[model samples]
Target: MIPARSGNIISTGSVCSYIGGGETHAYTCSKHAIVGLTKYAAVELGQFRIRVNCLSPYLLATPLANNFARLDHDGLENLANLNSNLKHVTLKAEDVANAALYLESDEGRHVSGHNLLIDGGFSIVYPSTCFSTQNKIENE
Candidate 1:
């Protein structure tokens, strides 16, 4: 990359990077660190035309998530969708892959130190308050 004077460094993160979820403290902290590293690296490497970014996706039905939630793929998907802000849509690995591809491609040439969230607006919605407010309005 140094020789080419251009490159992209994409790091994986989680929704925990922006908001605390059910994940362990260590897991959340590590995700936060990845975001920080992405920013710092982007600044340092910008002179070399190297871009650094992070992909922070919401919960997925991976083996790790399944183990943590003690639920199978279907069960986990159901749980995640229940709290998701987007209705009737589930996040898939392909979605994340597409985001990565965009970052690596020319379309994202000017994007750096960006924490691209692949969440279906999950991070922006606080489930407790959001659902409680909606329920109150519906009940009224």
Candidate 2:
């Protein structure tokens, strides 16, 4: 189990965008590494039928962090905004557990080395509706 983790290590180490203190890419990079690790491990473990994968999840509704439950609505929303594009991508433990169940079952029998991003829509972003406007602004 490549433990789904935060990008603290990579974010703190060396990403061109992280000049000052960028926790965003840090955790992003961490999860990215998990994907790479899962792939490499799965390739080696294919002979053994030992599947390897990652369960990359965003901010979940758990008591892992200190004073998280105490946060107000906006604060919570702000946290959800980080790393994910989903407005209110709140994840419950059951959601993750259900995914795990599917992965472990025969449904995922052949699936391996997947960086299953359980983030509501955080990892996947579509083209912006105001792309031209933003491009004009940048050019100006």
lDDT at position 41, candidate 1: 98
Q: Model 1: how large is the Cα RMSD against the reference?
A: 5.9
Q: Which ten residues in a row have the lowest lDDT in candidate 2?
A: 6-15
Can you write out model 2's per-residue Cα lDDT over 1-140, one digit (the tens) per residue? 23442111111111211121223445546645666667887787666666776676555544442253356655554665554566655666687778777777878878777766666664355223211333555677
Task: List where candidate 1 sits over 4 angstroms from the true fold.
Answer: 127-140
Q: Where does candidate 1 have its weakest 10-residue lDDT segment?
A: 127-136
Candidate with top lDDT is: 1
- The TM-score, computed over Cα atoms with residue i paired to residue i, of candidate 2 is 0.58
Which regions in candidate 2 have their CA more than 4 angstroms from the true location?
Answer: 1-26, 66-89, 126-140
